[model samples]
Target: MSRRDSLPPLNPTRAFEATGRLLSVSKAADELCVTPAAVSRQVRALETFLGVSLFERIRGGLELTPAGARYLSDLMPLFSALRESTEGVMAGAPGRSNVLRIRSPATFAVRWLIPRLASFHRLHQDIDVQLTTGSAPLDFRREDIDAGIQLGDGDWPETHSQRLIPNELIPVAAPSRARRKGWKLERETLLHSLARPEDWTLWLKFAGFSTANTNRGMRYETSLLAYQAAVEGHGVAIAQKALVLKELEEGSLVAPFDMTLDRGGHTYYFAWPSHRPESKSLKAFRQWLAKVVR
Candidate 1:
């Protein structure tokens, strides 16, 4: 290729990068300060320029194609470097104090974090925590978020992670449902979350039960939805113990069996890019999280 033909159009390249990283045209557009249609057009332009399909439309959202993933892996570092260089030049600019941006799983944020966040606010009145909900893999360089809460072993590459909470799984049902005659795991309707389809199987195995069939159930788009179904006495649902504490404590939901599955290596973690210097807000947040989790 000639020197003039080496690089793709900057706008299309940016649109594709953002879309590929975020996996949503609307989200990419929001980040780019453009319309969703514009983002879509730019992505198409880039795809046409490269002569390859970069994304596949999935049921609920977009999924990167194998080629797209590989391409994104290569493009991310370049974009990160560019952004870092730009920020370096713009350093010392006036900025807000102690404003922290955080991304977390929707259910966790709603059920656990938000409830306890007021305590953190009272403790560090100077700090402002802006929480966003998402369960996608974190790319600190690509995303504007300062920190993210992830459910994993804290092994994400180039991320500094601190364990936040143990992920314990237990089968729970509405009080009425649990007390109903003929209610048993082997017979009651099993509620499943599409996000964690294997949860039931994992819990069942740990509870010394056969993992033969966990597929027959009413599947919801999220754990929150499945838990709601359980709360309505629709079916028995496997729940992350931390996310349903209020329900359990308030007697809205009850665990019939005496078994709890500590989901091995998987746990909630507070993570951020290791390369970035830790800010006062981050330190305060981390310490507050530690105190609360304990």
Candidate 2:
């Protein structure tokens, strides 16, 4: 066989790269947007081609053998260089220059990012940002997204998370409702978001209040809906301060409590794949986010 015939197939190499980098087949599957079984099959194929055990099971988790680790080390720079070359070519193509595709959580997009986006456009008119809303994990290989605004402690696997906003929790209510009912926590109905059920409990604990009544409240499918309910005077809602800043300033929502719960580590961040080259559009957007959040 020719020397080229001995090389592993491209799919198996990619599968091995992802699995070896993350050290978890399931996580690698998530990043690749494939099933665990498929990832496992490709990994096995690569192992057979290499004629060496790539990973070993220890305590029901994956651990890379010495051979696998060495092989992965050699592959990392090659993959990185490949990514850079592809990005460079695509960037120079006509009509694609300075265009950025990004993802963000729906609530944060609507409440915070979208509202501030006009300023960014005014500052950097050359860059085009196409924003989509979702909290799903980012997969640069499987998706066309350039970056995402995620809520986390910047610990995402194979992702670089730049913190944008600190998540501080506070209870908010309509001004009329607070005025009429005095906004007492024990007397008022607690509005809750199905997405963040622990916000109220967390805030209550921070404020030295019992969490006994946190479960008794109206629930909405999302934090945005809960905020709307609070605006309409239905009930008091726990809000991340950053999301409610405009409403608070506009007098649509009133925070009766003096206390705020700073969610440790979990904050709004601008995240992108760690392995990919940062595009011009992404750099402009990241700079704008930092400036606005300041």
Candidate 3:
């Protein structure tokens, strides 16, 4: 018997950590695939086992007690290291993992990358592709990621980045909508993305409109959503033409005009950590992506 042997169960610890971090039992439960009551019970078990109040129940939510916040800070890095070590060990085991974790933005994943995934799968039958989408800053060292596709000027610090798609904003809508509202770019109801307010403004300026006097319209969280709104005849959406090329060619949507705004700064890039040890699968995938983009 040793002092280190009397630790609480990992499940309860995970429940407590997730609940403390998210500040919601339901959200923690959702993350852990347990019920809210189960999460609450686990947290209570952890608190009782440790003899400390980890959280204070507030009027509408849970707030981490001072001790709990400090505890969470201490625990996250430990668990992260554990995960990394476990993964490294697992990677050495036979038939353990052939998955490549790809971080991507939602708009690109949905509108562009997903459609071409089949080709990648056909070429590399042993490699499994796992896509995770978000706009938050990525840390390759901290996160379990193989590669990423980012939209911006190809200038990421400490990362190998290459331009994949040239970005150009152009007005688009459903074919019927474009046909009915011919040659009325200024008058058409405008759709916009809340994420990139600059896309609309830049297109407006390029088309000789005073962005200061621009008309307002419905807003979505991403360009893909705005593009979908246009496809469904909601309104004219300023979109990256390269992303919507399939839709344009497939007859699901049509451009209202030939005008485009090609800014040098707005483009898509394929990126990976400059220091990550390259694998054969990663090399093959990157080569395939380069071929696709070209």
TM-score of each: 0.74, 0.68, 0.72
Q: Summarize candidate 1's per-residue lDDT along 59-119 as a digit string, tens digits.
A: 9999989889899878876776675455544443455335688999888888889999999
For 106-218, candidate 3 gives per-residue lDDT tens digits of: 99998889999999999887777889998765656445577898877778787888788878889889988888735576667889887778888888878787744444788
Deviating ranges (above 4 Å) for candidate 2? 1-97, 181-183
Instruction: Report the candidate with higher TM-score, 1 versus 3.
Output: 1
lDDT for model 2, on a 0 to 1 scale? 0.83
In model 1, the runs with Cα more than 4 Å from the true position are 1-29, 32-96
What's the lDDT for candidate 1?
0.85
Error of 2 at 74 (Å): 16
Put the candidates in TM-score order, highest first.
Answer: 1, 3, 2
Give all candidates' CA lDDT scores.
Answer: 0.85, 0.83, 0.80
For candidate 2, the 10 contiguous residues with the lowest summed lDDT are 1-10
